[model samples]
Target: MESAETNTVSQDPKKQASYNTVETMEEVNDSPVEEVRLTVAITDDPTLPCLTFRTWVLGVISCAALAFLNQFFVYRQNALSVSSVSAQILVLPLGKLMAATLPTKAITIPGTKWSFTMNPGPFNLKEHCLITIFANAGVTGVYAVNIITIVKAFYHRRIDPVAAMLLTHSTQLLGYGWAGIFRKFLVDSPYMWWPANLVQVSLFRALHEVEVRPKGGLTRLQFFTAVSVSSFCYYIIPNYLFPSITALSFVCWIWKDSVTAQQIGGGIRGLGLGSIALDWSTIAAFVGSPLATPGFAILNMLVGFILIVYVVVPIAYWNNFYNAKRFPIVSSHVFDATGAPYNTSLILTGKSFEFNREGYDSYSKVNLSIFFVLIYGLSFAVLASTVSHVALFHGRTIWQQTKASFNDKFGDVHTRLMRKNYEAVPQWWFHGLLMVVLAVSMLACEGFGRQLQLPYWGVALAMALAFVFTLPVGVIAATTNQPAGLNVISEMIIGYMYPGKPLANVVFKTYGTISMSQAITFLSDFKLGHYMKIPPKSMFLVQLVGTVITSLVSFGTAWWLLTSIDYICDQSRLPPGSPWTCPGDDVFYSASIIWGVVGPLRMFGKLGLYPGMNYFFLFGLAAPLPVWYFARKYPDRKWISCINVPIILSGTMGMPVAKAVNSVSWFTVGIIFNWVVYRRFKAWWARHNYILSAGLDVGVAFMGTLCYFALQYYNIAGPSWWGLNIDDHCPLAKCPTAPGIQVGQCPVH
Candidate 1:
């Protein structure tokens, strides 16, 4: 363990203010990681203001707008996940503009001595950071909303909006409490540095760059603006005027008549051997922009994809293992012996929503497409592999950090400065928030008009589970920036403990998974704030308010979309290229069926069709061992250690929702930018790569929203020519290839 007294750095305010100077930097004895030292400015302008009137107006506006737009876009084909970077970039000018225009006079309250100014000095970096924090809350997808969407859209059940609101608020607030609780272990400790936040820090620093022209090349802001404009104009051709270009499956064009060819080449139904997506949303939709991940990480995912899609899936499918031949080779829908859609209403008792065993037996037992089943198996493997991988690779570092976290003397320069300058957020604040949210959560589950069916103890249990897994998962994310999710595990636990209650199962999963997830997200932001030197109290207040506003606005948008749209999320009824498939929610509803309605007993237990899939847990648990052993023995060979089993296993995990084209295009972009471009154009890439990514996301979000409100809502379908009307045009690609299987539009094999 680090000797606290030996590592202590002087927290002199005067010394910290000169941190940008070389001499001051040299005296930073308790320095952090290399990236932090290089990128994050150690300087602290304590005099600079935050949470100004300008911050409130701009922050609330960004929060509500982003929450509305993101929720609106989520129901579309390529779920547009516009991150806070978009807001981080957009709000710079707005904040400055507000500072210039707003009244500068200080206003005092009548009763209290509190006073504030609309224009709080200049638009400093701290103000910009807080606005982005608001955006962070808006950008965090409301995971619990999926419970509402799936129940209403997929399951055709009634979920009271009030209950939905309560559910969402509780799950979100649970994370706030966790974030506050684990601040020392996850935030203050330099070892638990959230790597992903480095990008934001760099961007913030770049935006705040005082030098107009560094070395005469285009500035980051200039490059970002240019790309943003280009990306905006380019999307219209694919998103509207020529939709077919989104999926340019040339192989489908080559052999349009052959099912084998389409199945091999189609981007959605098939392997996507030569398929390419021109649309940015299509490319970066399902699993996020591949440009965000490093080349090594992308390679790990690609390897996993190759194994699952090419090797394991083909073998199982061709051999008809688990009767895979009856269905499409790649599918997310549940099916029966005849490969027809397994109608949930047939087996589910009305009113009560209970499972009917006789109906289930009469109609056929629930069977999944081999791909989706394998996805679940791999998900289980990912959880185990993550634990094993972290333990083997990062255990000692974590242990040391755990011990060191208690002593403030061991804190780094940033931490020491923050502690001396700002008042820490009391632990009781989070504790109180947790207690209040828990109480309200229990009330919602038991008192809501709709029978949510989750008992009081279940809520407590879910919170406990989330509380337990926060640190391990937080450590994985803090270091690798890849969140090994607890969604599957939460579902499994709830399903086992409380079987045959769909509402209860999803509710439990939402609490167990999203609470942990939100905690990590908040902690990540806290790390970012810690790096930026935003006051801890202001950070807490901004996050809490932003989260509240975001949740409210998101729920409002969802309610509006679900109510207004004609045949929304029902692909069978909606027109071709309608852009409201709700693929993610489809996956959620599928889980609700498998683990909630059906329960684990009949699905993966002795009574289940494929109990052998359970061995995946053991396989995942053991998969990391050999890699760990070899890395220890070989020591010098670094590549062996880089083979991330969790990421590899997760490569093809999103088959149905994220089509082959998505992965292919994501991988290609990741390789080009993160590998080739990064290697060849190191300086230029470092300056503009992440900025370019943010610019692209902003452009797409702006144009996509414009298209929806201006054209799609009015039913102004773009030119119905071959290029605009048809997508990929692989007629038989989405169809099953087995003989005598009749599906709409597909010829018999």
Candidate 2:
């Protein structure tokens, strides 16, 4: 299973200095040979400085920068995220520069046994790893942004800054406890490779290992620099100057008046069959690096995407299922039966904000597009299928790992090295931390009852659900790169229990779903640390400190943005081509209505309009039976076993957040790089694929953030010409032609 891309080279100076020269001479002396390989254990040296002052200083700076950049992008129209790899790339050069410049003199602590050097011995790999981990913690999308958006944008209410900060901090830290407890199942297992971290590992080796210029072809560093510079230069074209290149649907341009053309070819409003996107940000929006993902997994996701978008959505819309034609084909905004935006504020009682039944009845009923409805259906399916698939395929192995966790036997070479060299963080430590956070969370829930509307018992229930679902979801994410979310299920349960309380529903969902997902994210990082030979204790401390710092910094930035940006979430107030469309927040607002304001009783009740959709939960439970039965009935058929229903269902979940062009372009790139290139040029692909991905991601993110601040912030327009901002290249793509669709005026044929 090991490839050059996934393997790490030793970073010990003695080994690196001689190995590179010797290997090169041998390659030249002998005929074509297999490339030099190494195990996951990158080095046997045990004196590497991990928790150094320099590490903390760089980490704090990176944490602050990443938190600001990520929070800034979360509010934008595209919601383009800057990955921690950006920090990794930027930190290496900075760390080296610091190592070269800083004094090597040691500082002694009075009345203490501790003495440390400021220079920290050439800024070792362990310190670099810790810094990246710290940056990763800060770069995670803050879930509290949704809470802030809903309160200000929809409820027209303001929360105190202290309360908001506490809420954000508690929710973010609550997951770390769960992550620690599940380390045995998720992190200790050898099979949980966490494919995404492999990219980071590859990049780390490239930066730290001894540099040798390649004879003919580009070296790793040169290729990385070239790709990064090119990607940085190219992103400006699609990001700012020519926005239409992001989604160029030729079909829509050719047949501007055809409704079917608009439906099939419009990247924003339709399946985006023939649409082409030039923007890397758009291509990598929902799905991650195509070069990193496996070809088989991408193919499965594509199948699901086609089935849901092309077949199910179009059929339901054309047939007028739930009056789909009355609304936009795709939108996260909830609408009334008359095609007007549903105003939840009008139906709320004075200050209490409780639902007013009479007011609700006077207003039109809530309606969702066919695509939105399908997202819900698939969400339920994902929940059931993930658990069932894991049990069917991995039950015995999970049990074995569980039993083996208590023993002294090592699972793999990496674990053996870790056990022999490093002191493991005791399980009791994690248990103690979990209990402390649990108590604080409970108190926070009680204190914020008036604002969140969630009682102490509701908080307990949410935590309980998180504990129950964490293992299954974590397993899926660790292996498959897709984590089946608990958002839909949590909302449904809390909506039924505490009906008619929108804030309470979201609060419960936040604790239940977000905590579990965050825990899984932390566990994946723990695994990454293990692969890189970082001590478990140092990893835990860095992650904890980083999370706390990130919460404070992110909250401050969000508060500043909310106060400074007039009409923050309102699109009408922003000028043309403004990035602050708040698409993610809009989706959150819509969910609060469907599951909170309306309540599950009204939305999924026997007399409800979408009552049939409720049966999706039952369908999900049964759907996995056939897949399992086929796998067992024909055990020799390996492909049958590989069909993961949960992963397939994840493909449909992107409808609310991402457009069709993203998926299509992502798949195309994956096919070319992962499938074609890897199969034809295995050595070159393995050596360069992930490095190229990392470089591109970092470059685009760096340039995109720079553009926002330099041009967008100062209101410096690109150009007034159609070529500069061609968002409306195919103007009729959004035209309203069907009956009851009056939002957009269409030209007569």
Candidate whose lDDT is highest: 1
Model 2 — which ten-residue stretch has the worst lDDT?
25-34
What candidate 1 gets wrong by more than 4 Å, as runs, is: 1-23, 26-38, 212-216, 409-412, 575-577
Can you write out model 1's per-residue Cα lDDT over 1-749, one digit (the tens) per residue?
11111211222345445644323444463555644554566656665678888888889988988898789888877566777877887898888787788898999989999998888656778889999998899998788889888877887778888888998888888888888878888888877777667677767766775435656567766777798899989888887799887788889999978887887788878888899988888887767766666667788888998888878877887787888767877788888778788788877889888777788778877888888788888998988888888788888877777677676556787787788788999999999998899888988899975478899888988999888888878877786566778888888888888888888999999989999999999999899999888999999999999999988988888888888888889988998668888878887888888888888878888888878878999999899899999999998999998888888888876677778988888888988998898789766666676677777887887787778789987989887689975367887876776788877777766
Q: What is the TM-score of each candidate against the true structure?
A: 0.93, 0.93
Candidate 2: RMSD to truth: 4.1
What's the TM for model 2? 0.93
**Which window of ten consecutive residues has the lowest lDDT sum in model 1?**
1-10
lDDT per residue as tens, model 2, 1-749? 23333323444466445543223212221101122222133344555668988898999899888888888778878676898988888888888888889988888899998898878667778889999999998878679768877887657787766667767877887887788777887876767767677777777777766556667777677888898999999988887788778888888888877777877787877778798788888877776888767666676787788888888888898898888877767767778876667888767787776767788888766788778888888898889888887887788888888788889553555566677788989877778877777777676667754677888898889989999889888888877777788999999999888888888899899989878978988898898898788988999899888888888888888788888887777887788667777888888988999888888777777645687887777777777789889989999999887777787777867776777777888878988887798789887776788888988898799888888889977988677676676453555544433564566465432
The superposed Cα distance between candidate 1 and the true structure at residue 499, in angstroms, equals 1.6
Please, what is the whole-model Cα lDDT of each candidate in the order they appear? 0.80, 0.77
Clashing pairs in 1: none
